[model samples]
Target: MANEILVLGATGKTGKRVAERLQKKGIPVRAGSRQGNPPFDWEKAENWATVLSGIKKVYITYYPDFVVPGALEKIQQFVDAAKNTGVQQLVFLSGRGEKEAEEAEKIVINSGLHWTIVRSSWFMQNFSEFFFLDNILAGYFVVPKPKALEPFVDLDDLADVVVEALTDDKHNRKIYELTGPELLSFKDTTSIISEAINSPIVYEEVDMDAYVNTLRDYQIPEDIIGLMQYLFTEVLDGRNESIKNDIEDVLGRKSTSFREYVVKATQTGVWNIQNGQR
Candidate 1:
């Protein structure tokens, strides 16, 4: 029998897609979640061994983000656990332009196991599937960094790269920086979505302080709020504005654009607002 690949954060933006793609190819997959047969939770260390059993490859995506405090230590501990459990390969999802995430990447690299690090830019799904979805449904898009340009990557492209890394040896010991084909500012992003959905969406460029306050007013957790602040003020400051062709190099195809993603998402009724509900 083929070895099972464990996908942590199995229900997340990238993990879900990665797991689906692997399973579609008839590969064995162990969904690493709190609800799995052998449950896995980052906060709980006792079950690490149980979750790692018979798993030859693991996809590691930290919850919240790798920029959070103590993330490095957690990653180190998990790497050690995976090593001791006889896992052979690891594929890690990391954030672009984050020093902290880079530190965590080092842990995976030196684990003495085959590893692939995928450093990714901001995901385009933020507008349709995540935090920005509600704002878009309300016909308004508010963010702090209006001038900073980002090469927002499609999750499908990211998942494709991750699956390849897990299943192939050619991607081993390689670091892939994945980004979309074009750079876009917040205004450009909202404009594309506005045109795609045929809706008049308001775009507001607020100061970081105002954005932080709004997050607090909405009762967003302080840890998440801190991650947001760091991403907007430090990481999203044009450092990752350049496009990358790593996705093409890995998948033998071009990365999906934000406008293409918006058009596809629009057809899914995720952006459709009816009676003030999404």
Candidate 2:
């Protein structure tokens, strides 16, 4: 019998791709989103049962992530509920080299269900799809200039791995640290962006305090600012400044390179949108 998969955060970066890939292969999928049928909201735990009634597996990509405060308790609640409700498997999207994320991983490990963890590096799409996009279009990309190197991973490869994990039993009880083939500094990544967009996108490094103040000035929520601070201060502090072969080992292929991701993003034309400043 085939499992009915519930993809939490189904509209998110990784979850959307995973959902699409599963549906393409004709897997039974119930998209778990606030807008989905029998809506699933992390903050609203009351909605869990309606969404999980017939689901057997889950692709859980926590919003913002499990590192944020209150997330651990939420994970514990969700895991206990899933285990009791008879969900058979779980695939958790996790961050690489984060202690709090490690703690979150443990909840799944001890949940007494089949589980796989995708511990990922910084995403290449952050420049186009996330925090840096608006600034990139404006030609001035600003962030804390961490000296750490990052093997930025492609969401495509991540989706592939996630699909395999959800569908095939080979990946159960394993943790895959997914990353791109090469490590790149923020400067180097922006250089690729410059070439791809054929524009003068510059990378400017600022101090941590300035970055936080800027976020506050934008009236961004305190919780979001907290995640950003944790990422720049703790996760990006040269601790994960190396590459791993886990993606290739599991997929039986080499990981995507930063240049290839840049080329593809440029082809999509989303990265080249111009603002008046640019």
lDDT tens digits by residue: candidate 1, 80-158: 9999999999999999988989999999999999999999999999888876787788786778965578899999999
Cα-based lDDT for every prediction: 0.89, 0.87
Candidate number with greatest lDDT: 1
Model 2 whole-model lDDT (C-alpha atoms)? 0.87
Model 1 stretches astray by more than 4 angstroms:
275-278
Q: How accurate locally is residue 226 in candidate 2, as Cα lDDT from 0 to 100?
A: 90
Model 2 lDDT per residue over 125-215, tens place: 9887886777778787678868698999999999999999998999999999998999888889888888878788867889989988877
Residue 215 displacement (Å), model 2: 3.3
How many angstroms is residue 158 displaced in model 1 relative to the true structure, after the best TM-score fit? 0.3
